[model samples]
Target chain A: MGFDGDDTLWHNESIFSMTQERFRTILGGIDAAEVDRRLLEAERRNLGLFGYGIKGFVLSMIETAIEVTGGEVDARDIQTLIDCGKSMLAHPVELLDGVAETVEYLANSHRLVLITKGDLFDQESKIARSGLADLFDRIEIVSEKDPETYRRVLARHDIEPERFLMVGNSVRSDILPVLEIGGQAVHVPYHITWAHEHVEPPAEGYRRIEGMAELTGVIAAL
Target chain B: MGFDGDDTLWHNESIFSMTQERFRTILGGIDAAEVDRRLLEAERRNLGLFGYGIKGFVLSMIETAIEVTGGEVDARDIQTLIDCGKSMLAHPVELLDGVAETVEYLANSHRLVLITKGDLFDQESKIARSGLADLFDRIEIVSEKDPETYRRVLARHDIEPERFLMVGNSVRSDILPVLEIGGQAVHVPYHITWAHEHVEPPAEGYRRIEGMAELTGVIAAL
Candidate 1:
């Protein structure tokens, strides 16, 4: 069994949402939608250059701040943006409701691997703080969670896609990719999703569960 | 045999040095020594928070700029810093002299694994662009190259430290840690080294080669 980090087993997207809100306030007077759009544009432009993570997001925010403000952004505001990133890095990893119990329950009978994508230190720190790291048989912090990445990971661990099952919150990142490579996946929607991770659900291929509470039942039924 | 990326296989610190010089010019009038001191301090301070890579380095640079300028650093300068980071990310991966030939030569007879430590995406992109990726039997991009990390990697790959050999430029990262775990290592010094990666050479137990040109000779003798 493979578990996706971020919004899958913890409160992740909500933190990003909160940070974006804070960013909106920092760039006050600008239309929130415009701020968001410009920030997202900077993020997309930088995605290939900076990749993903709070550090990249903060950098993009700084870039967008300068762009939106016509290069008149306060240095202190830039400092504020940097501070936001630091705090986000130091943000406590809060496991979602019933996550600890469900993960612990499943670990008893299965080899659970935590496969996450993000900044290495940030992800590792979160895993350490998540307090549930011990339940995982193996932990993979990847650069991205695409089909090729999943294929490489599964091959490395000597597992066939047919026997593998992935659980996560992002359909774009966690579900579609796994199913594309012949693996079973369960989609457990989170209340908040990043714009980059938003994608239409596949018409038919995977199971959808309300949350971690239904994970074990789905796994058993599989 | 395990090889370190960055300075080991290609040019890395030189790019950082050039960027730091540009930073100095941007913050002109500040004592270059003071700028270097403050930037290094910021980097060390944020190391735990930002980890390693151009993103974190750029963040530290921006933070230090704010500090040196007393929160009055120009927003355009901040954008310049961001641009510096983007260019660094887009910078070409230039392999050190003889690295390609040496790595390829060894790969024919030895299981060469590339073990590097840094941001996941940055390191992955570097490896891909290095053109030597196909020669590596396995590639491990870690957050830190501590003794415990080396041990974990070796164990995962079923490599006993006594039989494992590591080649890299940083003694702190690639040599001492591997030596501490009973692994044999060869130090191939780069022309420049990052301050964070500098450490006194181990008193004994590892061979020192001036560069990749001498790598295969040392390996054969080992």
Candidate 2:
């Protein structure tokens, strides 16, 4: 069994949403919605260069601040942006409801692996803080969660793709990729998502549960 | 035998140095030397939050720009910073002199694994571009090159630490960690060094060679 770390297990995009809202207040002249759009644009542009993580997000925010402010952005506002990133890094990992119970239920009988993507330090820090580190048989912190990455992880552990199952919130990162590679997947939607992670609904042959609490039921059904 | 990817096998920190010079040019009115100092300081401060890689460096540059400019930084200067990151990412991977020949020579007789640390996407991309992928039995892209990380890799391969040999540029990252774990190491110094990677010279019991061309001789001596 494989689990996606960010939104699937805990609160992630909510932090980004909250930071973005704060950004609107710091750069007062711009329309709040416009600032959001521009920030997203900058993030998309930076994905290839910066990859993904809070650091990249912070850089995009700074870039957008400069563009939206027309080079007149306040130094304190820049400081505020830096602080936003710092606080997010310092933020405690808040597990989604029922995650612990579900994981505990399954780990008792099955091998559980935490496969996550993003900054390595941040992910490791969160894992350590979550106090659930002992639950996993192995922990894979990858650069991106894709079909190839899933295949590689499965192969590394000598587990056939048919026997592997992935559970996560993002269809793009978690479900579709695993499904494409001949693995079973369960999607448990989170309330908030980054635009980058939003994708078309999963195709047939995959399960979608309302929340982590429903995860054990799906696993039993499988 | 294990290889280090960034500076030891390919040009990495030189790109950082060149980018820093450009940053100095863009953020004029501050001492160029002072710009370098502040950039390094920002990078150290952000390492825990951002991790290592070009993305974090770019973020630190932006932060330093704001501080040094006293909130008056030009919008174009911000674009220039973004461009620096993009160009570095777009830059081709240049293998260090004699790396290909030496690796090919050693791989015929010994197991070679590429152990590198940084953003997963960036490291994987460089490995693909280096065209030396077929030479390694395994590739481990990790968060940090610590003693624990070395132990894990060695154990994963079923190779004892006493039989493992690590070769890289940084004394901080490559030599000491592997040495602490009872592995032999060869330090092939790169022309440029990042402050974060510098440490007290290898204490003792480590081989220091001038270039990759001298690597095989050290291996034979070991």
Candidate 3:
């Protein structure tokens, strides 16, 4: 079994938040909430325009700032946007529930791998900070995650897709790729899922669990 | 420019947080620091597998939990994961530094919009929670973000891409798409950025800033 990280096993992304009060204060007489709504729209627009990458998101914010300020924008506002963008690269990796336990339980019977992606250095640094290494039999990081990646991984391990069980929260990265390659996969929903990975009406041969805690049973069923 | 609401603007995400102190407790006998190191590696691997969405993040936690506990996992652990996951999803929206002040200041001249991608109900609720809805001249939500989407939006607004600016913390969503269309864009660094949006070689015509407060200068420079 393999697991995905970031928002899953850890509480990450604490840095990206914006206070509603701050947004309200900026828009002045305008409703702060309305500002949030507009910002959300802008993000959707940017995401549609760019896909799931970091650079475009930062630009969207700069664009939002200019638009919100009605083009009377000044250095102070730009600086605010700039500073946020610089460090936006770091994610505070906090752990999730049953993440430790479930992995351990599964480790008893399965060969586990930790697969993730990022700047490489950042990811490695986070793992070093996490204090829970040495559990997986293997760990791999790759730029692209899809059926091809899953197939290659399985082939490398000499493990049949049916003999391999993939557990994750996203249909995009975990379930879909693994399933696409004829591997069994399980899904555990996390909080605040991104829109892209959302599977409408679910997919075939896919199972859902509320969280990591339910993994043992799911694994048993598998 | 657009912004990423959940983590970029404010403090969000708490899925992996629950296990920190607990991990310290359980693995006290081991090199806690070392354990964290290995765990962090596993986490990086997980992110690549899961991407930026919430579901895979949660799964990473469970996998981490299982790895750390050495098969001593239990119900309390699982409960913790789910509870934390829900918290991450339902947690209050927070804003980054100077965002409120900057937004208000920018509102004096610019046309601001919120662009985000997420679940409909969740995104709408967050907009309400963020309290910045009225700050924007418009709000748009879409299922995808790509270069084509950016082109269409600019075309619909009858705004020349060169004259238009996209500001955001995400290189993938905000900066690149606008730049791809020959639009001007700015990069504002947020403290903590989501992993899925990471990009490289920043797009052309990208101007960088430290925070939204810098917008005043940036707008003037333009």
Model 3 CA deviation exceeding 4 Å by range = A13-56, A68-70, A85-91, A201-204, B1-222
Model 3 clash count equals 200
Interface DockQ of candidate 1: 0.90
Residues B1-222, model 2: lDDT tens digits: 999999999999999999998999887788998998988899898888777788778878878998888767766677688779889988999999999999999999999999998877788889999999999999988878899989989998999999999999999889999989999889999988887788888568998999999988878876
Order of candidates by DockQ, top first?
Answer: 1, 2, 3
Give the candidates in order of TM-score, highest first: 1, 2, 3
Ranking of predictions according to lDDT: 1, 2, 3
Which prediction has the highest TM-score against the true structure? 1
Candidate 1, pairs of clashing residues? none
State the weakest 10-residue window (summed lDDT) of model 2 chain A: A70-79
All candidates: DockQ: 0.90, 0.56, 0.01
Q: lDDT, candidate 2, residue B131?
A: 92
Poorly placed runs, candidate 1 (over 4 Å): none
Interface RMSD of each: 0.7, 2.1, 20.6
lDDT of 1: 0.92
- What lDDT score is found at residue A165 in candidate 3? 80
Q: lDDT tens string, model 1, A189-214?
A: 99988998899998889999997999
- Clash totals for all models, in order? 0, 0, 200
Error of 2 at A61 (Å): 1.8
| TM-score of chain A taken by itself, candidate 1 | 0.98
Poorest stretch of ten by lDDT in candidate 1 chain B: B194-203
Better of 1 and 3 by lDDT: 1
Tell me the deviation in Å of residue B168 in model 2. Answer: 0.6
What tens-digit string does per-residue lDDT give for candidate 2 at A1-222?
999988888899899889988999888888988999999999998887677788788889988998888777776677688889989998999999999998988999999999999877788888988878999999998888888999888999999999999999999899998989999999888888788778988468899999999988888877
